[model samples]
Each structure stands twice: as C-alpha cells, then as structure tokens.
Target: MMNRLKAALAASAVMLAPVFAAPALAETELIFNSYLPPHDELYQIAIRDFAAAIEKESAGGIKVTIPDTSLAPSDRQYEMVRDGIADMAIVSTGGVPQLVTLNKIGDLPFNSPSARAASIALWETYNTYFLPFDEFKGVKVLSTNVLPGRQILSVGKLQAKTVADLKGAKLWSPPGALSEAVKKLGAVPVNSEFTDLQEYVTKGTVDAMVMAPNSAKGARVLEYVTGMTQIPGGLGSLSFAVFISQERWDALSPEEQQAIQRAADGLPARTGAAADEVLAKLAPEMAKVPTENLEGAQLDEFTTLLQARIDEWKERAAKKGLSDPDEVLTFYRDVLAREAKASGS
Candidate 1:
C-alpha cells in the first residue's frame, strides 16, 4: 500500500513539473507593416534591422512580426497606425502632408549635402521642435530618414540641359515641397503616387520624374528610362518616419519603451548608409543609360530657384504659427553642416 501511494505521488509531480518549466510568453508583440516589398533595400535596412534590434533588446519579453504583405497602402500608413490596424509603420512625410507638415523642412530643395546628413538633421530637429505639433499627436515617432536626393529620370531622348529646358516639360511630381519646387521650375507637375510612376512614364503621360535612384530602381522604372539628369544636391530628398500607435506605446512599461528607443536611436543613419551602399551597387546597371551631370551655369540657376522656394517655405511655416522660421532653417542647416563635416562628405 505504501509503494502504490508513493508511485501515485511521483506521477502527479511529473505532470506538474512540465507545466512549471514552460517559458513565459512575450509581454508584447509588435506588428510592423511596410509598403516596400520584402527584398527591397529599404525593407532590409529599415524594417528588418529595426525588428531584429527590438526583439534582441527585449530579451524575449517583446517580439516583432512583419506581415508577408503590406497591411495598408502607402498613403494610409499613418491612419492605420493611429487606428490600431498596425502597431508600427514606415511612412513618407510627403505622402501624408496634412499630418506631417513641420517635418517637411527636410524636403526643401538642396537642403542637405547627403542622405546621412539630412537624415540625422531631420531626426534631431523633430525631437527638438516638431514634437509639440498636433500633427504627431496620435503617434510615437521612432526615427526619421531621407533619401539620397531626387534625380530627373526621363523616358526616351529628352534631356534637361538647363532650367529653360525644364519649361513646359511634363514631370511626374511627388507632393509637398518637391511638387511645389517642380511647378516653380516651369515644369507642368503631373501628380501621382510613387508606385504608379512607371505606368505614367510608359504611357507618356509624363516626360520625366524626379525620384531617388534606389527607389527608381526598385520600381523598375529604369526599364523605360532612356536618360537621367543627375542634379547636384538633387531636387529634394524625401523624408520618411518610423512610428508606433500612441495607444500601443502607452501600454508598454518604461523599461520596454527605453529598450525600443535604444533600438531606434541610430536607425536613420543606418538606413541612409544602407541606401548609399545599394545605390553604389546599382550604378553599374545604369552605366549604359545616357546621363548628364548638371553643373556650371545651369547648376547655379537651379540653386537660385531653390533659394526662392526656401524663402516661400519659411513664409508658409510662419503662417502656420511656427515662430522664427529662419531660426529653424538656420538650425537645420547648421546640423547638416556639422554632420557633413564629421562624415567627410
């Protein structure tokens, strides 16, 4: 009888031991939604690296998952995050102008010397001044980045030799500062989503487009592209942001928040570096494509037009109640200079 009782007790202990040894579930699972395809360079740099960093920093307490397909369209990203459809998303500031007005300071033509400088400057400025704006009220901004300026990608034999050449040209334009600048440059701005650029160019709906190299390559626009005008300082660099839902952010403990921030701290620079590397690799592929480098008198003319647009931007910002737009611009330029000098760009 004693042996049977001991056997029954041993069996009960074994069953309970299995349950007790099980690992604890993660406290949070963040779902990151991205519009870029899985294999795109930006996806690898911004989405993959960010997710990995967060997972590692959380030490199994938080997990991040990116869906195989984008949860929402590019323009709807901000709304998706704010509405809790996605925990986090990568969104372009130009794509959502109404919600990201102040952040467009980086989008001014010839604003920063390089992607690295622009990205760092944008991130720092956002933390300093743009945080108080109502535009960012419903989301927790993680980091900001900029592309390596916009170059003119023209289909067929068209070439923009000078500012006068741009007159009457039909150009596909992204919204915000770039669109405004394109109009001022005497090009007829044909507004469209970046994703639809190839169709528009192929159909001859537009004669040229101002876009980042990596983005143009990814969109496969190069297949129809016959010539490229590499403008110095470019038309402008598009600014991007990684953000999380305010509701989701509030749910995290202070330690968790810090852990996430630690992962995000250097993301802009990392992304900019990654983009530069990818562009370098893609350069050879574009070797046979006819290209012109804007310089000398033509380049100076473009730069002058850009300055006038900058003044206009300042006026708009001031009208929106941002005090000392000049100071803000000066601060951004200073940051860019410092970053450029430090990076030897």
Candidate 2:
C-alpha cells in the first residue's frame, strides 16, 4: 500500500513541474508623440499600424499608444522624444534647424511635385548625404517622409502674381528658408503653428501662409484662407521624421526591432496615400475657400522670381560654411529627377 501511494505522488509531482517551470514574458508599453491633432486620418493610421505591428510581433508582450494632442510644436518634438517625455514621435527637422540643419535640404526650393517622388528622393538624400545616428543624437531614427506639395494661401482676393504682390503683406511662416522666402517676397514673416495659423488669419494677424491641403484642412484654414496658389514644381515638399528614444529602442528584442522597421518601411507609401486621400476629400470644401491652381504664364512668372531667391539661400548657406551649396542643390535636383522618372511622375 505504501509503495502504491509513493508512486501516485511521484506522478503528480512530475505533472506539476512543467507548469511551474514555464517563464512569464516581460511586457513593455510605449507611447508615440504625434505632431498631428487627435484622430486625423494620417495620425490615426500611424497609431493603428504601429500598435498592431508591435503587438503582433511581441505576441502580447509589448504595446504602443499614440496620444492625439500635439503637445509640442513641430520643432520641439525631437527634444521631447529624446528627453523621454515620450518614447517616440514624429517631428519636422526643418522647423528646428538649429538642432539639425542637414535635414534643411527639404526646405530649399527644389521643386518636387508629387509626394511619392518627394518621399523617395528624401529617403535617398538622408541615406546618401545625411549623417545617420549623429544627426539625431540620443534618438533612434525610424523613418522620414514628405508632405504633399505646398500651396500659398492668402487672406484676401489679391493674387500673389509677382514678388511685388507681397509688398508689406504680413504672412505666417515656418522657420528657416520658408520664412526667409516670405521676407524675400516682401512679406513680413511671423512664426506660427497650424493650431494658431487660422486664428492669426481670422484676426488679420497675418495675411497669408504656405501649407499643404491636409494641414490647411486640419487647421480649418479653409474657412479663413481667401485663395490657394498651387506652387508645384517651384518649391520642395516639406518633410517629417519619426524617431524613438535610444534607451527604449535598444531594449526591444530583434523581433520587436524588425516590427518597428517594417512599420517605417511602408510609411512613405502610406503617408503619400493618406495625403492623396486628404486632398481628394478636401478639394470640394477647398472650393468654398476660393482656390486657384496657378499654371501657365502666372506660374512661369512666379517660378522665375522664386528661382532668383535660390541664390540668396546659397549665399546664406555658404556664409554658414556649408561647403558646396550648389553641389548640395544639384544633388537634390538630380535625385528628385531620378525619383520622378522612376515613379513615372
């Protein structure tokens, strides 16, 4: 009887051992600081895609949350993320040139027309010309993409046909060349974010601004902007970058890293598609905003004047010890052209 009892107890111990030895996986939660307002389609898309990818890759061991409010301006996003106020973020380097000037190539009037072309050319520029990890110290760069081509929106009916049309007009501008461009065009440049741009326009704080359709719509500037002049092929598309803290990034396992990269790998295409959707959806509403797609003689005239402004930028970059300003400009042009050809744009 004793031997039978011992045998049964031994079998029970063996059965329980496997369950006791199983390890519990560690779970991590990360956050994404968006430069977009809450629930904007692009913002939502990024959040959903990133969360899904991370969760799927981690097998419920990791999670990501994207908050809606742009708590910081576009310029401050990099610092905010690096400081670990947020684990990851999307930021505009051009908006904060003092922190990273090499990315300012996006600010030049390189005249990229389509988002697809712009995104491809931009990634190429970053890979070929820009310094990698050092360029964004303390942060792990994930992806960079371009906004759709920007258009000049004014508060009044007076079309900006020539440089002189901007005489003494007050315009809201982002930092760097875009601001300088405003000054060169004889408009006063007031630094403002999209959240405040419409208020400024409504209050007559500034007379006009240059922005993409999605931004113009997101900011509800359609209600305030008197007109939009499409400046395709005369100005470069704007760029935004996604980054994560190196500390948190390094902690992620190989599978998690690949999942994050995969999300970034498809970002340019995803963003471009989202931009197209926003443009299509916003067009009819923009019609009420009194937009004119400038082309032909008007466009030609504007292009000539804008081209002349490039010399000033070159001179400025030279003053700042940017070796080979023309070379930089040429490289951008060549890459942009190549991307256009490849994309059939």
lDDT per model vs. reference: 0.83, 0.70
lDDT of 2 by residue, 240-337 (tens): 77779988899888877887776677666576566667777877777776556667886676667666667766775576566787787777678778
Highest TM-score: which candidate? 1
State which candidate has the highest lDDT: 1
Query: How does model 1 score by TM-score?
Result: 0.90
What would the per-residue lDDT of candidate 1 be over residues 50-118, giving only the tens digit for each residue? 999998888878889899888898889999888888899999887787666778888888774578788
List the candidate 1 regions with Cα displacement exceeding 4 Å: 2-21
Candidate 2, residue 211: Cα displacement in angstroms equals 1.5
Please provide TM-scores, in order, for all candidate models, with all chains considered together. 0.90, 0.79
State the weakest 10-residue window (summed lDDT) of model 2. Answer: 229-238
In the predicted model 2, the residue pairs found to clash are: none
Give the least accurate 10-residue stretch of model 1, judged by summed lDDT.
Answer: 128-137
